[model samples]
Target chain A: DVKVTQSSRYLVKRTGEKVFLECVQDMDHENMFWYRQDPGLGLRLIYFSYDVKMKEKGDIPEGYSVSREKKERFSLILESASTNQTSMYLCASSPNRGGGNTDTQYFGPGTRLTVL
Target chain B: GQQVMQIPQYQHVQEGEDFTTYCNSSTTLSNIQWYKQRPGGHPVFLIQLVKSGEVKKQKRLTFQFGEAKKNSSLHITATQTTDVGTYFCAYGQNFVFGPGTRLSVLP
Candidate 1:
């Protein structure tokens, strides 16, 4: 079974505070993604990484950044937390970028962040 | 930009009732995938449709991919409480997800 673990299940942060959400996958996957899910907005991509030290901006990358120092771990960083940034954050990893078929993604439990 | 859209944002149904959700993409998709997310849980991969005008079934659930590769639908026959959650269609070259349709099954 593929297991993806996140650093926190629920987090509360004050405005202007920096926050870090960590994700680690045991499958040694090459692609990782971070998304924020809102009520009606669904899941909006924040950032993604295809390899170590290689990152790509998703649809919504502003106010969020990602780091992948190792192959199995990816971290999403919020430079400054704000009220509008509070949402359910999800992390996912895939085996490779379209090796044969690559739409399947394994996801972490997700972190619910509240910016106060 | 590649985008996916789902209809009927929320659906409430009694046990044994049928439920269906539609997904439409703004651009042609290379392939489409379906995911289920239980309330308060992360999304889980369900199935993927690669060919145009292909239909796949998993027990009580049926999935269809449009011939144009621009639309898909998920139909549940005799939905149960276990089916309660959100259904999302993920498309695009990188799998951009739709808004999702929340399903509520009443016992």
Candidate 2:
């Protein structure tokens, strides 16, 4: 079974504080993604990394950044947490099959962050 | 960028009732994938359809792709409380996901 784990299940941060969310996948997938799920809005992609040290901005990347120093781990960073940034953050990974099509993505349990 | 739309943003059904959700796209889709996300959990892959007018079934769940390749539907028969969750349809290489249909099965 593919297992994806997140650093925190729930987190609380003060406004203007920096927050970090980490994710690790044991399946050795080459593509990783970060998304923030909100009510009504659904899951909005924040950022994605296709390889180590390579990242791409997704639809909503204004307030978030991502890092992938190793193939097995990905991290999401909030430079300065704000009330609007509080949401359920999810991390997912998929194996690259050499096609443009995205395969099934295995997701972590998710991290719920609250910016106070 | 590709996009998919889901209808009936929310649905509430009694146990043993049938439920269905639709996913539509303005343009022809190469393939469509369905996912189920239980409350407080992550989305999990359910099935994928590529051929036009393809129909696939998993026990009580039936998924159908349109002949035009622009739409798809997921139908659940005799939905149980375990069937409660958000169902999403995604397409394209970027995997643009639909807003999802939240299902609530009442006992």
Candidate 3:
């Protein structure tokens, strides 16, 4: 079975603090993504990495960045946490497809971030 | 950019009743996918529809894609306790899901 593991299931941080959320998928998928989910707004993409060192901005990417230094791990970074950023963060990975958005994405258990 | 919208943000039904959720998109879709996420759990893939006007079934669940490829639906024959979850429909070149329909089943 494919497993996508998150570094933390819950986190709390103070305003202006830098935060990191880590995700690892053991299935060797090449495409990974970060999204934030909130009540009413649903899930919005923040960043995605298709390969090591390659990244792309999604619909809502402000104040956030991602790292894909290795094939199995992806990280989401909040440059300066704020109360408005508190939400459930999800990490997803899919097999690489040269074709756009045509692959099946597997998701990890989400991290609920609470920024004070 | 693609836009996928789901209807009836929330639904409440009695066990053994039928339930359905609809999804519409602004543009034609190469494929449409469905997912279910239980409360406090990650979203899991339910099925994918590739052809226009396609319909597929999984036991008590039925999935349909519109003829124009811009809409889709998921119908449950008889709602059960296990069917309580948020159902999402994603339309795109790939498999990005949209806002989901949250279902609550009552005994």
Highest-scoring model, lDDT: 2
Q: What clash count goes with each model?
A: 0, 0, 2
Superposed on all Cα atoms, model 2 deviates from the true structure by an RMSD in Å of 1.0
Residue pairs in clash, model 2? none
Candidate 1 local lDDT, B6-83, one digit each (tens): 999999999999999999988888889999999999999999999999999999999999999999999999999999
Q: Model 1, stretches more than 4 Å misplaced? A: A97-101
1 or 2, greater by DockQ: 2
| Ranked candidates, highest lDDT first | 2, 1, 3
Listing candidates in order, what is each one's chain A TM-score?
0.95, 0.98, 0.96
lDDT of 3 by residue, B1-107 (tens): 77889998999999999999999999898998898999999888889899989999999999999999999999998999999999988656435668889999999
Docking class of 2: medium
By summed lDDT, the worst window of 10 consecutive residues in model 2 chain B runs over B89-98
lDDT by residue (tens digit), candidate 1, A1-116: 99999999999999999999999999989999999999988888889988999999999998998899999999999999999999999999998856556658999999999999
Mark the regions of model 3 whose C-alpha exceeds 4 Å error after superposition.
none
Model 2, span B26-106: residue lDDT tens: 999989999999998899999989999999999999999999999999999999999999999988766678999999999
Give, for candidate 1 chain A, the lowest lDDT window spanning 10 residues. A95-104
Candidate 2 Cα outliers beyond 4 Å, as residue runs: none
Per-candidate Cα lDDT values, in order, are: 0.93, 0.93, 0.90
**lDDT, residue A45, candidate 1:** 86
